[model samples]
Target: MSYQALYRAWRPQKFDDLVGQELVTKTLKNALMTKQTSHAYLFTGPRGTGKTSAAKIFSKAINCHFQKDGEPCNECDTCTSITAGRQNDVIEIDAASNNGVEEIRDIRDKVKYAPTECDYKIYIIDEVHMLSTGAFNALLKTLEEPPENVVFILATTEPHKIPATIISRTQRFDFRRIQPDTILQRMQYIVSQKQLKCEPAALKLIAKAAEGGMRDALSILDQVISFGNDEVTLDNALMVTGSVQNDELLQYLEQVTQKDTAKALEILHQILNDGKDAARFIEDLISFCRDLLLYQQMPEKVENDELNVVNDDFRNFSQKIKPEEIYQMIDLLNEQQENMRFTSHASIYLEVLTVKLATRQTTISPKTPQAAGEKLDPKDTIKVENLTRQVKQLQQQVEQLLQNQSNGQSVTATNSSRPKTTSYNKTQVRKTTAPAKVDLQQVYGVLSDATRTSLNELREIWDDLLNMLTVAQRAVMHVSSPVAASPDGVIVTFQFDFLCQRAQTDQPLKDTLENGLDRLIGHVPRLIFMPQEQWPQIRQEYLNGQKAQKHLTAGEDGQRTEQETPGDPKQPAPKDPVVDTALKLFGNEVVDIKND
Candidate 1:
């Protein structure tokens, strides 16, 4: 019974009384002064930003018997009657409650009559967006072409909801939220007028809690005043509003900075135990982090109680955190806040959030680096090793299959249609069945030729490698040498340096090389790949053969030596008739023979 909400008591009564909305006030005053006031005027803005107050004052100003300049005389009988809500000519209706077609039709009927005492009949409607479609249609005619003596003043927080047709017939004014300084000044004036005992810090806490809505700030003040009689303090204000004090927030931040999960969770649990809303706590944390971000970015703009919310200790803590990190923290807390709505276990959420934030933040103290390092176990190394082994195995399997496919051999499969006996000469069979069986060098040659033109072309044949081999076997394959087209077949080389690196002898690689070359060329190819370290020796042997004219080019030997051994390093090295013929047809530039 003793309660009087501060917002209602502090409602603005004059144009100058409006806060943080100079544009709206100036425009309305100009309109009133020029006698160019529209019959229907629409006011739109966020809640508690003087939209309704301005509408009411404008209505009174237009019909005041003792108007001065562009404002109403508050002492006049007409102004008094309007303010008291006793004037029939000045009507104030809540569209939220009276948003039916019948209500609008009733107003339409009443608009036909003229004002008896006041110069104009003023109708002020609040929350005009709540009107139903039919009700809006009913009001349309009167709004577009109202009676000469009547004026319709509509106010809405959401102008988008109102039909464009209604908006077009009216003059629209948008209101903005009150600034922090404006709210602070207004609050100070209210405290002085009521003779209330309050700290300036308490006023700032209330202003920040309101988030730019004057109504919310006033309501908070009203609640705080009630909690502590007529005297309001910071503690009492925070208590009533469930806003955790800055000191408590800083303590939580310190625990996190120290990576003290246990302490952090305990503190969070205590907050929950104290019956504070978990979502609201998360929201306040977001706001606290936002202020830290602003402090880091624009320290000069932050002042008043917003400055006191963060102390030197908190400033140091903020300095340790980057703006991006604080923003990420806010984002995470906001997500948790939304999730908490559906979760019955809000405490669990808060605890998890506390651990997450605390665990991720780097400590300000240099002494805790080792402890932080130990906190995250190096498990990724094991995963990386396993993945590398798997990839190697996969590459080996790709090579083996490619070899089998090139050989025209139906790779070891369970199908009954597979040949029971393979066709080959005794030496070829011996080479295939030998202990050092898989010819890796020949497989490399086949793959090299296959991939010579493009990588995409080779990828098509890569999958066929799987179909050509036994399930237990895999071969690490690669194109070791460039391709050269010859009348007999395409020549290639496969690098098997990995085999030597693994300490495996080159016999198996040679066998794989032979089989793969025979399949790719339609006939067995002369393949060459051995230990990389032995490559210089092999090249010397070839040079010795070419110089001596052995096994090939016996007729053209002397003639070829002069032309083949060009001084330019870029020219292809001279080789046997097989290589020379292949290079000539394939284009000499197309071939590259890497010794290793």
Candidate 2:
């Protein structure tokens, strides 16, 4: 074979050689030394975090002829073959490629045969999450209880995709992303062992860029070395990684958070012109903001470069910017990042994002919590004010009448002591029989801007809404069906007129219904009820009224675009139907309704 890649050549061959997985190594070594190993094991984590390497080492350690205290003697024939991937017993399978039921069945059938080259037959399946659902089902029985002396080791980056049944049957070991410092030390050792000249800053950059994956760090390092003709430098590392200098990223952030839009956009233009990825720049900015926020809160955590974003400039910038401002910038950046994913012109998004962040207001004054958080509809406000004013006027009139009676003490009071009936000509009182009529204003209010989606949203919560009420309240609601809904109100047609009248008059039912709906959907509705038989006529009348209103608007404007669009904008939406009704009722009607 040709020369192996750095990641391949530096693959951990022994449990002790594994980096940054002390707990995993310790447990595996204990199990092997005590001759107590699981029939199946799962190794899962981010890519290049020593999952497959750990699995391979475990396989060799378990089957090595010269195994000593769970350590594989690489000199032994069995261990050497496994290391070379030529061992018959240590079977490595790429589940991503051969993930089928038949392939798994073949393995199941072959497991019965004895090991030819080693004491135990070990199966290592890499990227095992790619196995089909049927393939996972096929391997379940064999995985849970394979033939004696057979072991299965499954490795994957995405453990969430794996079936719980598969994970439950195996002893799971979670591999963490290798820390940057740990990777830095490992890279330093690799460079020294190879006797190559490399910059400390370059190694640190590669380590941070690896993002907790040692294999990724090494691969980046390999590319940087190749680019620098076997000599690593910071410039080569930066070119390979496409990361802006720390000072430059810091400067860009400072300009943005300080509300310097032009300067920030200029910096972004230059950075993008240098071939830096827009998406990558977004991610880098988000990460930088994260570090800045963290450093601002915990300045002591910067020891040993623990945060991996520390420099004199970063620290000073962190001091200059408020943590909460960083929070807003990060939020804006993240939103733009999601938007960037759907578009090819990422530079446009980046520019827009820069301007938004730069101009974003940082000093947000906290809102004083209101006793009632929501504002009333304009119609509701007018009704309340009119009612209040009328009440004050009535109180003053009543006081005047009382004062006049007290001062006069007239003969009417003396005459009221005797019981008397006044017989006036043409004075007759008789009760008239009339059924309760559907309130047109109420139905029209709900159907004003009603939509199918709003009706569906109301109906979807009907059962839950009923469940929230008392037995009597539920009984009143059970006879009701939501026929139409706008954002602020719903028209519920009742099975009976009595129930409809009861729903309107019952104060308790009103509160629970509206309040429960508000709790469920975060908005209260002006619930209207009418007998079910009257709903069709009312809906037809409302639609006709809408058409008439549209016709009137067209006559006044000399244009009708209803054919082009099914519904014309001439029919103003019920921004707040209750408010409009109040305004109309209170003798103050605007000829044109502003679409606010």
Candidate 3:
């Protein structure tokens, strides 16, 4: 009387009629033939995998008056009524809506009664996971011990949510998503059966877009047929589904591959202004890129259906894009899609994404432009000032290591062998008479002549100020260690915090420190910053200067003192003068030192 949709019209009427699931059908058929069907059944799988349809077929097969070889006799009144959904014995329920405990109780109450007309009363519950916990508990008993004449079939897309108790009593059948080739063959058969006017490429596109869902493919085909006056055409199908035309997407992709940002944005704007949903555009773009990748990796694996529907130009374009580039493009589109969902300014987000895509070169390109490269090189924007700052850090380390060595700290083999690239020496010198303390003023004089104009300007006032400090303070100021240098001046960092704190105590003291540093090196120290915690350790070291003076006296004698603490000792020493001094200075604290 009325035209039926393709999905409804082509609904599988028999187990044999179901496509891409012969194993399931054969299993059920064998069970029916031997009267080995379970009292309860669970069907689980993705959408359009025929779980519900298989349940119906099973019901009809068991109830058919003239059943033969485990198949239903369509001519029988029982089979006819079940097929038309008019049979009282075969009941279908949508568990999603009637998932309360009360509904389950009602089913439980009725489950005990025998079938009125058919041999078995079959109950099919779809989306069974929607059942409440209480409902599942109620269904458990009936499922476990139902009447001999009753059968229960529960179906759900998500099987993991089903209670294990309920699952234990049932024969679970897992349905699989139909393969593309399987769906394509079926679509071709359907078109032939109906004598429908369609292009081969159109059918393949429908199959691929269905994504392993037969119902989806049929639904899309139905829309296309309706829009094309009973003839399902490629153009109508693309328009109905709002899929991007291959050529248009190819043009946008070419611009991106070439890193033409302006052209890409212009094309995207044109598409958006034409009323296409940016979100949908992103979705289609992802699909287009995925197809390109699939074709590139395994050309023989590509299904010929709708892919064949694409014009020659689009096919050529798809070939032009490499698999890696297609992967990157898909990733970008997916990111854009996610941003669009929550963004208040979706259009702007889409615009920015398109511009970014256009500015990205092909993934496999050997030579990348500076602005549009995947990975930026650090050398691209080298700053000489940073190198100078790093060099200063190296100098500080050398000064600190030299101090520790003179104090008899253990020298790590790794550290002793480490190389230096600058003018500084990497050689390990045996302790010599703490080399006649270098004269800070004389050092500045030599530096003044050897240094460049920039260094000379910074050291100008520094040499004059150093002439005033005591020899001890001057010795503490060995090699003005480097700090963060600037364009106009350089930073002189002190080796220890005591030096910095002492320099900061008086205005002239600070000026003396800066001028001496500048005079010896090339830059006046600007800001002095130290690791905050290291400052306290440096202060403690200063307070312990008396110990170093004693150690020097002890070293000058023939009596040997331990250079560093051993990792483990078998016996504790009664007490030594040097050990007592260490205990006084450190007060039971552990000080890590290295030695051979």
Candidate 4:
């Protein structure tokens, strides 16, 4: 006999042998015992969860002549032939390959014939969802009115794609993913039966890596056994699964908590150099952080779950990190994991993520006394205490000054000639409240040439413009409106000063708005940001300055009129250009000349 894989050699031949599907096995066994089995059955679940195996077992049990306790007697000739795949009455079809109308039609035609050597003819169609529309239409009629002693078992990972008509006619059983504990127990049984030496921890790790799939667990176990020397250890399991050791993962996490970028990168590089997968490392790290968080919240639960053990080092490390920081780390690691899926440069992203984790600032309050004592030097502690004392003394002095003023007494110096200090004194804590700088000149220039028509056009489609921006950009511009507009630029005023400043400095946001406007309007005008409170004042200041300048100019013109002669032909017209242009364009009486 050729070498057989573990999954193939250990295929369950009876319903009772199936793992992690008690509900399904029990139901099927009861149905078989009562002789009330349905003609068409649909088994749907995730891959490697015993859907097909259960179907095969049920087929054998229903056909076996010497069935005991609703289980097929493997000793019988009928069960033997079916187990060996030599029975003509029981057929297994791969719907993925034969998903055509002709194949379904062939089944429809063959289903009418009576069983040649068995009591019933069973057809197991795996991946039935892969069938074409025409194939489903062809199978629907036969499934609805199958011949007596004929059974159809449809197995698929995705049941949603199956036609409702076909699903309505069949009895559906939904299977669930096997739990890790159940998988571990089964692995232990298999290892013990095969006389293989394996560590308990190794089995547990395999169970976790299986991710609720029995076949996958068995496959991983087979690979590990083949690689090891008759004895499987935790190291061998980790190596096969491309996972890091617990101690190494803890050390890497310690580096992150300590904010040691260099050491964390070195550890990451070593892991990658040793052929560990970057994605797996990230996944393990994320799991480790989650465990730490859970331990922090519920230590008793963590202690109970053998899979989530909290060692002395892990518990100690949990105290050093805060729950909030751990939450942030998990979120960031999850983002990196998402990014790793679409890019081949996973190592680069891993390195960058490592640095981010190492350098991430924690918002936790002051460190614990033990932590502070460990990191702070004695001399630095002394310096901090002295500075605190000096601050207290300064505060006391200010309070005393206020008390003296409230009591209507001046703080007089010891010497009579010296000056008295009072709270109202200008030299006492002078606060320079400088207003935020605004370029009134530029604002005035824009306002002077502002075009109302252009402003109205932009305002009409302002909502549309906002729609073109990203969600974040729209949020930032929500409190803003276009107050002034021109052919060259537009002035947008914000209700809050901070938003005005943000809009002024956010170049990318400005660029996005400009691009959006360019698409909406024919031209992209420059955006000018100003606070609503400051806009009116700046405009008024500009107008008042203009008026003052005009008044001064008119006064100078009046003074010049008194000095200039009416018709002075011999005075060289005072040699003034303004006086000469005034005499040339208008008559001397109507012209007002200014002279220096």
Q: Please provide TM-scores, in order, for all candidate models, with all chains considered together.
A: 0.59, 0.62, 0.58, 0.60
Top TM-score hit = 2
Clashes of each: 14, 1, 10, 0
**Per-residue lDDT tens digits of candidate 2, residues 1-596?**
79778998888888877999999999999999998999999999999889988888888888876788788988888878888889888889999999998999899999999999788999999999999866876787789889888999999989988866688889999999888889999999999999999889889888888999988998998898889999999988878888777777888988887789999999999998887777778777887787777777786776456437576777777777776787788889889988988898988998898889887877765663365486768998899898998788666655654565556532222234333333222112111323356678867776666666777788898999899787878887887888778888888888777778787788657756765675578767787777897878876676667656766777799775344433666874434343443333222433454433
Lowest lDDT sum, 10 consecutive residues, model 4, at 426-435
User: Per-residue lDDT tens digits of candidate 1, residues 214-259?
Assistant: 8888888888888898898988876777777767787897787678
- Candidate lDDT (C-alpha), each: 0.70, 0.80, 0.71, 0.82
Candidate 3 residue pairs in clash (backbone atoms < 3 Å):
204-305, 204-306, 205-306, 410-594, 410-595, 455-522, 459-518, 459-519, 462-515, 462-516
lDDT of 4 by residue, 1-596 (tens): 99889899988888878999999999999999999999999999998999999988888899888898899998788888988899999999999999998999899988999999999999999999999866876786689889989999999999988866578889999999999999999989999999999999898888888888999999999999988976779888988998887789999988988889999999999999988888889878887888888888898888897775568998899888888888889989999999999999999999999999998877766777687676677998999999998788667667777777677666654445434554454333233423335666566666656656777788998999888676787877889898777677778888877677777777667756765675578667767788788777765565567556655776888754334655766655445433342343233665665544
Q: Which parts of model 4 are misplaced by more than 4 Å?
A: 361-596
Better of 3 and 4 by lDDT: 4
lDDT winner among the candidates?
4
Off-target runs (Cα >4 Å) in candidate 2 are: 306-312, 363-596
lDDT by residue for model 3 (1-596), tens: 99888888899988888988888999999999998999989999999989999999999999886778888988889888998999999999999999998999999998888888999999999999999866775676678889999999999999988755577789999889998778888888888999989977677667767878899988988888888987978777666666666677888888888888888888888877766666667877787777677766665555464344355666687767677777777778888887788777778988788777776656565565655666655774466567887788778777766766667564343354355333222233313212222233332333222224433354564455556465765765553443223333343546555555554454534544543453355444443433233435443453356456666777899666565455458755334443453343343446433233
Q: 536, model 3: CA deviation in Å?
A: 50
Ranking by lDDT: 4, 2, 3, 1
What TM value does model 4 have?
0.60
Tell me the lDDT of model 1 at 459: 34
Candidates 1 and 2 compared by TM-score, better number:
2
